[model samples]
Target: MSRAPGQFTVVAPGRVNLIGEHTDYNDGFVLPQAIERGLRIAVCRRPGSRALLASDRGGPPLDIDLGAPLLAGRTDWGRYVAGVVAGFQRLGWTIPGFEARITADLPSGGGLSSSAALEVGIATVVETLAGQALDPVAKALLCQHAEHEFAGVPCGIMDQFAVTLARRDHALFIDCRSREVAHVPLGTEVAVLVIDSGVKHALGDGGYAARRRDCETAARLLGRKALRDVSSIEWPSLEHRLREQEGRRARHVITENDRVLAFKAAAEAGDWPAAGRLMRASHASLRDDFEVSCRELDLICDAVGRLDGVFGCRMTGGGFGGCAVALVDGPRASSIEALARTACAAALGHAPEVFLTTGVPGARVE
Candidate 1:
């Protein structure tokens, strides 16, 4: 396709939760980094108040009426784009009609926040056309709201925040409740290996919402505003008061929050082993307590964790099969990947997509 006269591109990175899982919605802490793989959107203004959207992923072009009400029964990807447009309208920003073509290396439903990358990338496109930049936090929140209101997912601030505000060569330490952020350097000693298990997770399934509901019920039962209010020291005494499932949900959030802080400390001190241990523990909590892991995720984590040069391995993302992340010694990364591929292929009949990635800057116009 020929470029429009004033066309520009926006790039947004997908993120991997290095440790904390499912704790974001509980108003807890999370440590995540934006990975180098993500979406690229080439966009330019059009003549009228309608938006035309297309993707290299092969779908009919989505033409959205900017002035019309959001259709309840639009296609999944279309809903995401329209959601962002609705968000911009809600903010009183006058968005012009535009044509955007999205191409991405990020794997959708692999728990790398491809959906957030798309939303943020489109929002950035709108922001660029509007001739003003929003505060980073507000930009992230706007995308988050799009997910909640349009995508119908009750996600926490972590994914959008990391995708919008992440710095290169750093992990974002986010206090989901306060919206405070700290950039922790991911030094040169360790490498982050992300393994796609080939199992896609659709959070729109009731599994995700069910877990969130359990956490809320647990908090109400414990007389706390949210699980974040319940300290680690206080959890044991309160654990027995709730039913088995609710208690487990609450336990995961409380302990995961603690692990996020400890992992931050380990990262700051350049302690890869300590950070790896925390990653393993976080995966266990998500698997046993949060009940989000599937056999593919468990098998991959177990196989990778047993390998040499791998500091730690665990299932990442919203679970039920997406990806696993490992912290490995930088020098042994290639060997580790080879061994992991052989082992996983032997067991699963096919090798997974395993690659090394580092922290990269968040969404921006190019």
Candidate 2:
């Protein structure tokens, strides 16, 4: 028999934000799905007091003391792994040595929340090894802890929280601050295709950091905690007061919030057209206001927009050359994929990776 060794595995899916974008960090609501591609971890307890984290992705595996300060590792991603260990310590769990083998199908910078997957995957495995089960809400928080503490990014709870809590073949409607969740059904007739530009994103990179700063700036100017606190009717009036700030940044959040609410209704009523149009507008806002989309993102979305069978397309994730999400009719999706591949290669000199996504359960064993 294979060496079980008190070992357990946890698989955590990567997420795609259907509409909500940068709004998550501002404590705004988001609609995300835990897609088919995800991170898988095999975690097993050992007799030692040391923890070992390893990935077969042509990088160094990390071995660190559990009780010490979480410091920078040989690689940047090591911090996220370290954060997961530290987070468990914060919970008063006595973590002995364990070995983790990590792998993911989600592209690193495709904006699919692969980092969040690593965090949650570690949490799920550790919790299982410790003879404990984390409530989905708590799992999300723990994963967020890794991101904020170890990863050193001031991120919102949406990505990790959504992947940990969302159900398969369903969408998660999350109120960022409250962390309240509603599971919405996905359309059976229309499918979602994620196109990866093979562009990687690291939020600690200044672009993501600056956007976080802008949201804080917006909150300060509006005299509220976040954009989510702004009343729908009062948003325009508040915007008139913050003349010192950029309109592009403020408008994206406000309008994206509106789109989320409208998309929810359209989704419930089986109005794919309304949902798809909102998606397109969301991308436009991200492009024009947030300035996160790159030339690659623009080109891919633009190509998909002109397709007759695609209801709509938009750049997903933190933008800056990640992936685009498209809603396509069942009959025409094959042609759409071929065109996207050709267009992306001709425009960017890279063939895109396209994924057909359906939601999956939060954490599972192989």
Candidate 3:
């Protein structure tokens, strides 16, 4: 195959939530890490008025005018790229028309941040082409805005932040309200595995949005600006003020944020057992109080929760259906996978895709 000269390659890694589910949108805390799997964006200047975008995953090419208005109602993957281009323009960067090809090893709905990888990868490519540099903070916030305004998912900063600023072999501990990030290393002899439940979820649907609304209502009723301001200590009294579901949502956010902080402390002290216990507790809260879990997710967690070498297992994404992560002994990783597959097939009528993963570096130019 003939290749164009000066074609730039950009890589943005996907992320898995180690803990802290559904806490991001509430301006709470999240522990996420960039994974080995990610998106690859290759680009070269076209020297014309339009930009051509195509993907190796089989979709029609998107031809966009360099000067056209950036619209928000797009319902396809191209919307992600268009959103980044629009973001660059909004940030006053000069981006020439270009031909770009996208490819990925990341699964779209496996609870990994595939969309953020695409958006950030394109933003990096655009910045390189424009001969300018955007700092990590600016890059993350910009891509987050792109998702909100263009992709129509009111996602939090955790995905973009982890994709842009993650460190190798470390999980990012971020306070969404403060935007402060800390990189905590994984201890030796520990392994992280993700088991894809073969279920996909769309966050734009009412389920995700409805949960966010409940949190907002909880905040308003408490006279606080956000659920982040409410302490877990106050949950007992606060639960009586709101309706059952709203109170449960508030309880999850406050308690989950606490779990993240405790987990971070435990991880820093090389206390894998404590960290694993926190993860199990977080999943229970998400399932019971938050009500974001589905049967498939429960099956994975229940099956893996009792394995001898397994430390903890819990559903890892925005919920309803997606992947679950398990922390286990490095040598026992394969055993856990086999156990999960057998148990899931017997209980859920299907087997899951289980694989091992580790924390890797964030997005960058290749």
lDDT of 2 by residue, 1-366 (tens): 355768777888998889899888888878988899888887878777778878867577777787675654435677887788777787788776788788777798789988888888877777777778777788888888778766667788888887788897888999887778899898676778888977787777778878888878888888888878886688777777665445568778888988998998998998888998999999988988899998888888888777777888899888777799988775666777787677767777777787677778786666
TM-score list, all predictions: 0.97, 0.94, 0.95
Evaluated with TM-score, which candidate comes out highest?
Answer: 1
lDDT of 3 by residue, 1-366 (tens): 555565878889999999998899898999998999899888888786578889887878898876776878888888888888888787777678888888898877878888899988988888888888898899999999999988888888999999999999999999999899999998557888888888888887778888988999989998999998888787787778898889888888999999999988988898888888998998899999999888888988888887887888888878878788988887777776787678777777877677788898998877
Position 62, candidate 3: lDDT: 91
Q: Rank the candidates by TM-score, best first.
A: 1, 3, 2
* Positional deviation of residue 100's Cα in model 1 after best superposition, in angstroms: 1.3
lDDT value, candidate 1, whole model: 0.90
lDDT (CA) per prediction: 0.90, 0.81, 0.86
Q: Candidate 2, overall lDDT?
A: 0.81
Against the correct fold, how does model 1 do in TM-score?
0.97
Give lDDT: candidate 2, residue 256.
93
Expressed as tens digits, the lDDT of each residue in 180-216 for candidate 1 is 9999998878889999999999998889989999999
Clashes in model 3: which pairs? none
| Ten residues in sequence with the least summed lDDT for candidate 2 | 67-76
How much does candidate 3 score in TM-score?
Answer: 0.95
